[model samples]
Target chain A: MDLFISLFINGLATGMLIFLLAAGLTLIFGLMDVLNFAHGGLFVWGAYSGIFVYTWSGSFIVGILGAIVTGFVLGWITEKLIITPVYGNHVQQILITLGFMLVLSECIKVVFGPNSIPVDVPSYLAGSWEIGEVIVIKYRIFIIVIGLVIFGIFQYVLKKTKIGLIVRAGVMDKEMVQVLGINIKRVFLFVFMTGSAMAAFGGMLMAPYSGVIYAEMGMEYAILGFIVVVIGGMGSFSGSLMAAILVGLAGSFMAYYVPYLSLAVNMILMAIVLIFRPQGLFTNAKEG
Target chain B: MRHEKYFSLKNLTFLIIIIALIFFPYVADSRTLTILMTQIFIFSILAMSYDILLGYTGIVSFGHAMFFGIGAYTTAILLSTYNNTMMIFLISIIVGMIFAGIVSFLVGLLTLRLKSHFFAMLTLAISGLFLVVAEKWRTVTKGNDGFTFRAPDVFRDRVIFYFFVLVCLVVVFLVLRRFVNSPLGKVLIAVRENEQRTRSLGFRTLHYKVTASVVAGVVASLSGSLYAISLRFVNTSVMSMDITLDALLMTIIGGVGTLIGPIVGSLVIETAQHYLSGLANDYPIFERWIIFFGMLYILAVIFFPKGIVGTVYVKYLTWKSKKAKPQLPTQSVPLVKDKERFE
Candidate 1:
């Protein structure tokens, strides 16, 4: 029972990180119909930059803030430069974004040097609590709390705000929204930027969780984010959350029980989902 | 009428090129040049197979390396485990191709029903699964360190092997040319242009796609076998994403739909890679060749979207039309109508 709870918490924390990345990917796909493969590049950058600031300033909050700023800036640049030209063409978008992904990864090697960097949990978030044979890591609990808070905040904003309604409307029909006099283009830019920022924020949090950050981690986690997006259903926020948790739990348990299958478990789960429910676990909000 | 002529100018040009390449090993005598040419031939075959999916059928699969790896591993395992006789070498290629065909067929059936982005991501994930399997099944694959094996005596001779691979490249190219021009190929093209319209026309698009996938898989496996033979070694790197990206780059940079374009693209890229890496020995900055490669890729997509051959062909057509005398309105009307109907 203790092992199960510990595994469950671990999975939840990992799922939250994946959700941060997939939420942005699904939203960008749903609203703009643009699949940004370079979203992963934004993630690695967030980790590198956030960790750099954390070490320099010695404040975790400042590090998170730095990461968000970097995300917004990179998001704006990607949308304006790399993404703007290849809009509406899926093949070009995939190729161009893939190219950008390579550039981003290589640039990391250039900037941060070609070595993995180890990170430590913040002082406040270190250690664990033991409650009668049930021990809980503080960092893991902290991550779960942060993930839920972010989820709650985004959920509220998406449901209650005027921009949220506009974004949702844009997802359903960009032309209809445009005809109604909303600058759907600006909304697209906003969504793209926000999605990218979230990816970076996820990367920042993932650094301490993983303990080591490398240039290639972006591609690795990006694949996970893509799987989560597919399983959650593209453009569905809650779907991403549900699917992320499921993948996290599956991975967490499988690693402990069947080490040989851990690497392939996510792929098998995705294939099964693809074969049976091609629309993903939850249909897109727009479609639903 | 031009195509009907057996000895047309185009046909003659191709024949001359083939004859020249056949005599290349004798004339070059340099081992480095021969090796380079052989590498180009092998990759040209791989890129052309990719074109069948990406250009001819409008399907973008990111997991193409899986087929390549299957072929490489099959041949590598067979030759090392058994005797390296000529018969085994021949049988290994066939067996590898069959294995690749089955896997690709299954993969296509499972994933082709999804949208493009979903299909791409699924294939990538599946290929990653193959990589994991290869890594974990270290006893058979020898793990990431890989294993080297001897080939048949005939293949041990570089000159003989070079010609053999050249012949394979030529044969594969001609077969693919005929494939993309066949009626079935035309239907594939129709599907690419507009899947819904083709479906409305009563063509089973899925069947056509699966067929293309199988053909591509078999051809890619053949190249993988050839690659393993050329190196006398096999490794999990054969199935890496880098190999798939190379195919994609070759197809796009040469000319997507043009069968000959991938050959040209492979030549340009392989030569550039060779020179850049060679330069890396002297210049520290050149060590990061992939960064330059990535930049070139981005530039190619933005500037030469049609690729070298495609852009040149379009230009030649426009120039020829400009030079020709204007057609009478009555005559041009039928021509325009014919073109519209054909399209």
Candidate 2:
């Protein structure tokens, strides 16, 4: 029971991390139809930058803020420079973003060195609570809480705000939104920035959770993000969260039970999904 | 067809290149260059195979290295166990190709129906699974520290190996060219241009795609076999995403639909990589040369979206048309007459 709970929590935390990355990806992809392979680059940058600030300022919150800022700025620049040119061309987008991803990852290596940096949970969030036979790690709970809060906030903003309505409308039909006299380009830029910021925020959160941050982590997690996005519907937000949790739990359980097949389980899951529901588990019927 | 005879510029250039490649080993001063040329040949074959799917069929696969890796591992395992040189090498390549074809056929059946990005993503996932299997199946694969094998006596000679690989490259290129120019290839092109239209026209687009995949997989495995023979070693890097990306970059850089473009692409990229890494010691800036490589890739995509060969081909056609503009006056006069009569 204890093992199951811990594993469940572990899986949820990882899933939430992936959801953070996938949410931005799916949103950017959903609205803009841009496949930003450099999303992973934004992630690792956030991890490194957040960790740097955390060490410098001695506050995790400041680190998170710094990472978000970094992400927003980078995202804005990327949208303007890299992504704008290849709009509506999937192949070009994939190729250029992949190139940019390499640049981002290499730049990280150049700046921070190629070594993985170890991170620690904050002092307040370091210990675990023991309730009878169940020992609950504080950091995992913190991650879950943070993930839920962000999801709630994101959902609220998306549901209630004018920008949210425009984004949702844009996702449905850019032409329709443009016909309605909304600036779809501006919306695209805003959404791109927001999505990048979320990815960075996820990276920042992941640093201490994984206990190590590396340049290559972006690609690794980005694949997970892609998997989650695929498993969820391409642009469906709630689908990403659910699919991420499923992937996370599956990964965790498989790792413990069938260690050899652990790496392959998600892929097998993806393959099965592709065979049956190629559109994904929770895709909005009309979106595609 | 009459325009593409021995005197044509295209044929002449091809003949010249083939002749030069034939004589290269004999006249070359450095053994390193001969080895590099061999490497280029192997990669060119791999890139050409990739072009069949990406260029001809419009199927962007991310797991192409899986086929190449399969070829390498098959050869490696066979040679390691067996002392008979001819038997093992031939058997390994044949088995590798068969295995790759079978796997691709299965994979295509599952994945070819997906949207472009979904297909690419799924292939990546599938390839990642192959990587894991290769890394973990230590009993057969020797895991990360890949095993080495002895090649037949004929292949041990660098010049012999060079010519052998060159022949393979040229043969594969010709075969693929034939494949692409065939009536079926036209169907593949049609499918690439508009799958819905092709489907509506009563063509089984999926079968054509699967056939392309199998052909590509077989050719890629052949290259992989050559790659293992050239290195006398097998490792996971052969099947890594990097290899797939390298082939992709090569195909894009050269010219997608042009059969000869990938060869040129491989030559350019491989030579540049060799020289760039060599210069890293002299220049601190070159120490992180991958940044520059990435920058170049981005610039290439932006500036030469049609690729080098495709752009050149377009330019040649425009220039030729401009040169023939004097003849168009007669044609336009008739059109003018027709327009006046209609009025």
Candidate 3:
């Protein structure tokens, strides 16, 4: 029971992180119709920049803010320069975004040097809690709480706010939304920025959770994010959270039980999902 | 008259390139250039195979390296075990082709009918699955350390191997050219242009896609086999994302859908990589040469979206039409017209 609880918490923590990234990816894909392969680049940049600020300013809050700000700026620039030119062209979008991904990853290496850097959890969040035979890591709980908080805030905004409604409406029918006289282009840029910020924020949180940050970690985690997006059903927010948790749990349990298959477990899950539910587990049927 | 002119120019360029490649080994006589050119031949084959899917059939795949890796590993394992070059080479080609065919068929069946991005992602996952297995299956793949094998005497001589690879490349190029110009290839173009309409035309689009996938896989595996022989070593990198990306880049850079364009793209990219890496040794700034390549890639997509050969081909057509009096559209002209949208 203890082992199961521990694994479950571990899985939940990782799932939350993946959900943060995938939420942005699916949202961007939904609204902007851009795959944004460079999403991973934003994640790694957040990790590196957040860690850099944390190490320099000695304040985790400042680091998180800095990372989010960096993500927004990068997102704006990428959308204007790289993405705008390739709109409505999936092939060009994939190729250019992939190129940007390479450039961003390489830029990280250039800035941070070609080595993985270790990061420490903030002192207040360090250590663990023991309840009977179950010992829970405090950082893991913190991650889960933060993830849920972000999800709740976004959900509230998405459900109640004007901008959120517009965004969702845009995802459903961009032409129709534009016909209603809202500058859908501005909304696209805004949504892309917010999505990127979320990805960076996830990376910032992931740095301390994983205890080490590297340039290539973006690509690694991006693959997981893509898997989550696929499993959750593209353009479905709640589906991302659910699928992420399932993938997280599956990965955690597989690692412990079938170590050899751990690396491929997410991929296998994706394949199974693709085969059985090609539209994904929770697709927006109306759009499809 | 226009058809004759176009064919003569294309034929002339093809003949010149083939003759140059045939004589390159003897003319250069430098071992380094020979090896480099040989690598180009192998990759050109790989890129051309990829063009069949991306350019001809409008299918985007991210797991082509799986087929290439299968070919390499099969060849390595066979040679290491059998110690007979002729039999091992023959067996590896057949086994590699079959293995690649089976995998592509399964992957195509599962993902091809879905939206394009799903197919791309699933292919990536499938290739990554193969990569993981290749790394973990220590008893067979020897894991990440990779394995080495002795090649037959024929392959030992760089010049003989160079000519051999060149011949294979030319043969593959000619065959693929014939394929793309055939009636079936036109159907593939129609599918690319409009899948729904093609299905309404009573064509089994899925079967055609599957056929293209198998053909591409088989050809890619052959290149992988040659790559293994050239290196006398096989490793997991042969099945990596980088290799797939390289093929994609080459196909895009040379001209996506044009059979000869991939060869040009491979030559350009391989030469760029060669010189760029070499420059890194002299200038510290060039240490991050991949950054420049990334920038170049972005710029290429923005500016030269049609690719070098593709752009040049368009220019030639424009020039030819300008010289001739405006005439009624013909079949060949319409085919060229269909390709213009990619630009």
Candidate 4:
């Protein structure tokens, strides 16, 4: 029972990290109609920046904040330079974004050097909470709480705020929103920044969980985030949540039970999802 | 005109080019001969395969390497464990084709419901998922250990692989050329230009897409088999997004619609890669193939949207017209001659 409890918590924590990354990805796709393959690059950049700041400043919170800011700047520049030109053409977007993914990843090696850095849990979140025979790490619970909070805050902002409404509106009909005299491009810039920041935040949070930050970590988790987005349906927020959870649980369970297909399990899940429901589980948003 | 084909200059030019390609390999040095021929055979097959999805069906796939990798891996594993290359080739080709078809069949069934953009993203995601799995699953794949075969025999070496590829490329090319010229090809073209219109044409467009997709899978598998045999190894690199992008770029650079385009595209690209790397070794200042190739790609897409072959073919036609009427103007005559110097 304790083992079961441990596995469940571990899976939940991983799922939250994946959710944070996937949330950003789905939001970008939902609103922009651009599939940023470099999304993983952002996640990795977040990890490196967050970890660097954490080590230099000796403050975990400050490290995370710095990471988000870094992601925002990168996102703004990337949007202006790379993504802005290839809006309507999927092929061009893919080519350019993929190139950016490689460049961004390589830049991580340049900035941080080609070594994985160890990041320890902050003292405040270092302990474990025991419930009868079950023990849960304090940081895992913290991750879950943080994940829930981010989801809640974003959900509330999306549901009750004008900015959220505009984003949702943009997702549904960019032209219609443009007709109403709103600068959809600015909105895109804003969403792109927010999404990048969110991914960075996820990476910052993931550093301690994985116990190390490597340049390739972004590619690794970015793939998981992508599968979640696909299974959850592209651009569907609630769908991302459900899909992330499903993939998380499946990954956790399958790793122990069917070890051979462990890596392939997620792929199989995605393939099956694509086969049965290709538009994804949620495609209700009307977009042109 | 003595023949219907001769009535059209394009067909006549195509015939001439085909005849030249067959003869040029004989005159080239061994290294250049093998490399260029391999590029033509491999990329022509890949481009033809890609056309099944891109040109004919209008579905742009960012992950076509999944089939290619699967084919290569299956063949490498079989060939390493067994001796009969023919049987292994047959099994791997079938497996790769079937697996790809099944995956696409399922993916297409679902994604075909979405818009083209969403569907394309889904394919990209699926291939990426495959890459991650291939990389991490260290047991069967030896993870990244990557299996290599013993150099089989001299007669069973590069030349042998070259011949094998030649036969496959010609067969696949002719079959597809015929298919596209047939009623089936019209259905595919119709689907691409207008999906709803094709559907309203009382055709099950989904079935046509699935069929084209499988054909593409089979052809890609053929290249994969040759790649595995020639390189004497099979690894996840075959399935990586880079190779898939190369195939996409090859098709894009060559022009997607024509049979000759990918062949030309691959010839330009692989040669670029070979020469670029060679240049990198000679001049350390130009070490970055990434920047160099990226610039070339950007220029091609931005300035010459028609692709290398398509744009050149257009230029050739314009020149032909001017050459036929050298009486037009000496100024125009110089321009035609100058342009001919470049192609």
Measured by lDDT, the strongest candidate is 1
Q: B1-343, model 2: which lDDT tens digit per residue?
A: 3234668887788889999989998888679999999999999999999989988887789899999999999988898898848877899999999999999999988899887888888999999999999999999998889988899888878999999999998899889988988888889888777788999999999999999999999999999999999999888888798899889888888877778778888998899889988997998566677787788778878777656777787777667778877322211110001111101
How close is every model to the real structure, measured as TM-score?
0.95, 0.95, 0.95, 0.82
Docking class of 2: acceptable
lDDT of 3 by residue, A216-278 (tens): 889889889999999988888888999999999999999999999998999999999888886
lDDT of 4 by residue, A134-191 (tens): 9989999999899989999999988899999999988777788989999989999999
**Chain A TM-score across all models, in listed order:** 0.98, 0.98, 0.98, 0.96
Query: Which numbered prediction scores highest in DockQ against the true structure?
Result: 3
Clashing pairs in 4: A275-B106, B138-B143
Q: Write the per-residue lDDT of candidate 4 for residues B1-343, one digit (tens) a residue.
A: 1235544976777678667756655656486668667766786787778867776677777768887887777777776777754666667667766776676666566666656555666676677767767787777676677878753454255566666677787778878888877788778877776678899979999888877777777778777766777777778898887777678677767866666777777887778777777896787534445545555555555455456766776777678768897433221111001111101
RMSD of each: 3.8, 5.1, 2.7, 6.4
Q: What DockQ does predicted model 3 obtain?
A: 0.54
- Candidate 1 Cα misplacement greater than 4 A, ranges: A284-288, B325-343
Candidate 2 off by > 4 Å: A284-288, B1-3, B326-343
- Write the residue-wise lDDT of candidate 1 on B155-199 in tens digits: 877889999999999899989988988998888887777788999
On DockQ, who's better, 2 or 4? Answer: 2
